[model samples]
Target: MWNEILHRSWLRLEQNYHFNDSQNVLNVLKQAYAESQRAYHTLQHISECLFHFEQVQDLLGDARAVELALWFHDAVYNPKASDNEECSATLFQDLLKDDLSTALLAKISQWIIATKQHLPSSDQDLNLLLDIDLAILGATSKRFIEYQQQIQCEYHWVDSEIYQHKHKQVLTHFFLQQPLYQTTFFQDHFELQAKQNLTLALAGNLK
Candidate 1:
């Protein structure tokens, strides 16, 4: 399934510029997603984002750019690293600079960086990208619990108390945000459940 997505995404890029080493690039991306340290930020996460993107593709200004951004958003994830988004965006540009226009590459880089704050932006495509990246927050109870566990595994080096403290702060920030999701699609489907999930998790009720 992931391979098929990669193939289709590569084909989309091919439309703009011809690249001969797509297979090698795809392999590198696959390896990044398959890294042993990843639990939540794995290929499955990319697939989830793709699934969400398809649901709202018509709303995007540049569907192809948004799709490509999803592929590289977490390409350089490191739980302990503060510059993962920067690094990932750099990698995205490095890999596709030859195949994409400078303007489109900059747009994609902006979309990837927006994931760091998950805040609404003036750009509709960016709003949708952020929404898709965070859709997991509104998943079913079982899946939400699984996501929490996976996150813990990714940050296993942190002491339990410290982790909880930091986690609570993060959840609180989301709760304080006027609307967690910017897109109407996500706002309608996930707004309430997302609040519930975050509240439960922050209150130590989701464990």
Candidate 2:
């Protein structure tokens, strides 16, 4: 998966660079995603994001950049930490710096950073990437419930009450997004169902 996606981005960038170290980087990323503490933000989540990326590839300003950012977005997730995006972005640039221009590096890093909030954005690539990262919010009811459960498991160390209250705040944040889905494609396909999901979750319907 990384091979094909990385290769595509490399070709499109047309850099005088080499990733014969590709396998090494992939191994480390696999290890990161396979950590025992993760209930979500695992390789499966990346695969899911990729699935959404495929859906709106044509609508992106830079498909390769979007895909590249997706691959590294949650690459360093730590449910207990606020700096996961920073760490992930740094890891991305550190590993691929030789192959990417400074502008592209900033673009990718900024995309990963933007996911920290999933806030509305003006950049087309950023908007689509944000939409793809958040597509889970508008997934089928079963999957949405599963996602909630997965999130809970990831934070199992927190007290139930604290977790519940904090979790509610997070859900409310997304719920308050005047328009949760940014792009027209996502807005059309996910806006209604996502609103329903957030409303129900906030109303304590998930259990």
- Best by the lDDT measure: 1
Q: Estimate each model's TM-score.
A: 0.93, 0.90
- For model 2, the stretches where C-alpha displacement exceeds 4 angstroms are 1-18
- Alpha-carbon lDDT of model 2: 0.84
Give the count of colliding residue pairs in each prediction.
0, 0
**Local distance difference test values of all predictions, in order:** 0.86, 0.84
Q: How does model 2 score by TM-score?
A: 0.90
lDDT of 1 by residue, 1-207 (tens): 865765666677666456667777777898999999999999888987887888898999888788889989999998989999999999988987887789988989988988997866898989999999989989887888999899989999999999988888888998777798898999999889999999898888986
Q: Against the correct fold, how does model 1 do in TM-score?
A: 0.93
Measured with C-alpha atoms, the lDDT of residue 105 in candidate 1 is 86
lDDT of 2 by residue, 24-128 (tens): 666777788889888878877887787788788888878878887887898897888999999999999998887778998998999999999787777888999
lDDT at residue 41 of model 1 (Cα atoms)? 97
